[model samples]
Target chain A: MVTMQNYDNIEYLSETIRVCIKRRFGDDCEIANIALATLGGSNRTVLFNVVRGSYPLRLVLRQETVPSEYSPFLPSDMQYRVLEVVYEHGIPVPRPLFELEAADNLGQGYVVTAVPGETLPKRLINSAEYVTMRARFLQQSAEILAKLHTIDHVLVPGLSALQESSDPLGAQIALYDRYGEPHPAIEFAFRYLAKYEPEHGAKNFLHGDFRNGNMIVGTEGIRVLLDWECAHTGSVMEEIGWFCARSWRFGRVDLAAGGFGDRETFYRAYEKASGNLVDRESSRWWEIFGVMRWAIYNIMQSHGHLSRERRSPAFAACGRNTGIIEYDLLKIIAKEFD
Target chain B: MIWSARMFNDPPNASELLLTVREYIEQLLPDLERQDKYHGLCCTYLLDVVMRELEEPPNIGDHSNNALKALLNNKDELSETEFMSSLCASIRRGDQDGNLDRLLILLTSHVSKKVRVSNPDYLDTKDYL
Candidate 1:
């Protein structure tokens, strides 16, 4: 229920944030330019610059918003822990600074060093500066995911406590049914998936929301794989297939690997990095499942707007916008039958 | 008898009215701030959808009902909502596993018709139809 007005009082936030930073970096720290981030829709992101003696630091503060219907079980502190583990293991993740104390009055949230790069899909795919980077996009994504999947759940604290589902298709069906809304396209897709469920592979760490928009692209390649809120212990193919999902392509349907490269190139890179064979059939199955999941998510987002929990034009448009996804789902599923 | 019925009571239909409002908002967009401009663009897009709906109403209800009846192989006179719910339940129970070929055809046609109303450009770009 945090309105836009709650963030307007910069003075109150600056005072509270200053105390949190002082506790972390000593009493000589000063916080400035704390304002809302423009990009994310689910959480409240505040970017600020901190000065401690002669050193200047750029950091981001992420706060939890009112829980939407699709919000994952991983809280901000749990995500901070996951980031800590990922960063320590040489993954390109923003360094976790610290979690806010109860006295900070910022509700539930944490801070991380702000990595400088572009996360917008349009710029990453079409911009002149990223032309060369686009060539290595798929390979780099594969390498990162391969490395991420190798992380030990026991070593990474609190990761095992996060939900794990062996039957992802069943879980998705239960979720759709719980929504109490009938989507014929989604039901049809789910039925298709159920009848052709792929063989389950070994469970591994999954970057739940690994896609074009979730990544921060730099001149070299992916600077950081962001948004670990959906991270879970699942099949490696699920992560690979989620990346190749058409919805994540963002209108550049020609390039299947997040609009960067073909599916073969992506699969090859992943195999090279993980030392495991990639099954095309399994990946395709997950891709179809990913599309259906996204369509359901769109419906949930529109409901959020309709129920007045969150009011934004973007959310309101999702209900009708599902048509395009439905079309894509039918096309992919039909090809399998053929 | 012909003169008794009034013709052209309103010159502009619902579609025309929506177009006029959308045009006015587009004109005022340049003066608005960044956030307001984005919201104005969304409003314009919504109005465009409304105009499309008015010009050619989508036949989703009829199409869905027909698809459901074909899947169940029954001609029960059920409401669109009820029929879809029953079909979904049947699908969840794996009733369509043996007849996937038929279900696939029905689903494809159903979604294609939906895209025609919501975003026909999808079909044109993919060359699906």
Candidate 2:
């Protein structure tokens, strides 16, 4: 992991500004401190808190490429730009403040956006403040999600550059195929998603990872969709399904939508806001896909540790859980499908 | 009776042993892609670990698969659901550290005889990996 000190170079900060922000905002701002968040992601998020007198400014800094010592797949500038476009459509994200290439004002590539709410996964919905406002959270989240999917898939931009498969079912099955073995756990999920593929008929917006972890849970129970890096154009059910995925329940499995409330509550909220029918069966199909998708993501991060360049036991030890996830999926599949 | 290589000086996290033990062989990734077949399995191993770790008490799974061994013992008697349910109940019953230590010890015994050789009669809650 590149330490925070390494990023404190004054020359680099000036260069980063020149390339991405200064061209737009000019050089009147002064950086107060450079800080990093070492959290659940593979990127180095250096926050530049600049002193613009009374009105302080915060810029989120991430590099297109990171040293080999870190995870190699830190999203590139291209990936960051794609996310910016997603944010532009008002996707409950910190609007893309700036995008830059190497220049004297900023080092390498940098992008900055005002920080959103504190990124808290564990406390958000569980906090007493969210209980009474629970229904609003679900309704607003589904409404925002509906808007995200309703956007013209073509205009969303960066679809081709991101990962895609021949068809929705094919993409899902191929994902499972990558992990061989007829283990009852994975097979159960595989059969269900394949057998009962959501017949949504037309593709729509998909927030590939929409759950408690990605969302910002706040006062109004508002869930600002975060992390468009994994966003894709797919069945609208895909996003909803992810919201209700078992893994995302975070122990409160009873409240399906990020464990905040039940499916009826979520469904009513979504349908009322989006003016769409609740596709219960299709949601089930996507929910199954959500678990599989999460499993794949987990395995990939764990696997990356093996590369000498990015070797960290912390990463590698995480790899040993496919079977367990598969086990959960299989049980769910058997219970519902068989 | 044996001291070799950098012994106690090593901070456990940064050791070469870390590289070998963790399944993510990103270094070996290139080799597997070239060899052509096992690459998928190799990759799957790492992904499983990453996803689970991201969830909670992350390191619990890999070092000790011993928690549910009793379920495995009655493999003939236990259906998949029954086994899983029982194990899940057992895991939820107490402190995670105690459970993890017990499981790790069991795994150490099963995977290697070194623990047995060093202390055959050792059996106590206090012992830890």
For DockQ, the strongest prediction is 1
User: TM-score for chain A of every candidate model?
Assistant: 0.91, 0.80
Chain A TM-score from candidate 2: 0.80
| Model 2 Cα lDDT, one tens digit per residue, A1-338 | 33333345545644554345555665776665665443243454566666656887887766532343332132555456656666778777765655554443333444556555634554665767666766776777778877776776666455633444126555554544443322323433444465566466666756667777676656755635555555566677778888998887655767878777898889888888788887898887778787876666556555555544234444453454454444345445545311
Candidate 1 TM-score, true structure as reference: 0.87
**TM-scores, one per candidate:** 0.87, 0.63
Candidate 2 Cα misplacement greater than 4 A, ranges: A1-27, A38-42, A64-88, A104-110, A158-166, A172-188, A308-314, A336-338, B1-129
Candidate 2 interface RMSD after superposing interface residues: 14.2
**Could you give candidate 1's per-residue lDDT for residues B60-103 as a string of tens digits?**
44664475588787667778678778887787778887877777
- Write one digit per residue (lDDT tens) for candidate 2, span B1-129: 112233466454232344455445655455653222234344544444333233333233333333444524544566545654454444334322344434433433332222222222331222223
Question: Judged by DockQ cut-offs, is candidate 1 incorrect, acceptable, medium or high?
Answer: medium
Q: Write the per-residue lDDT of candidate 1 for residues A90-116, one digit (tens) a residue.
A: 999889988877876777889999988
| Best model number under lDDT | 1
lDDT of each: 0.77, 0.55
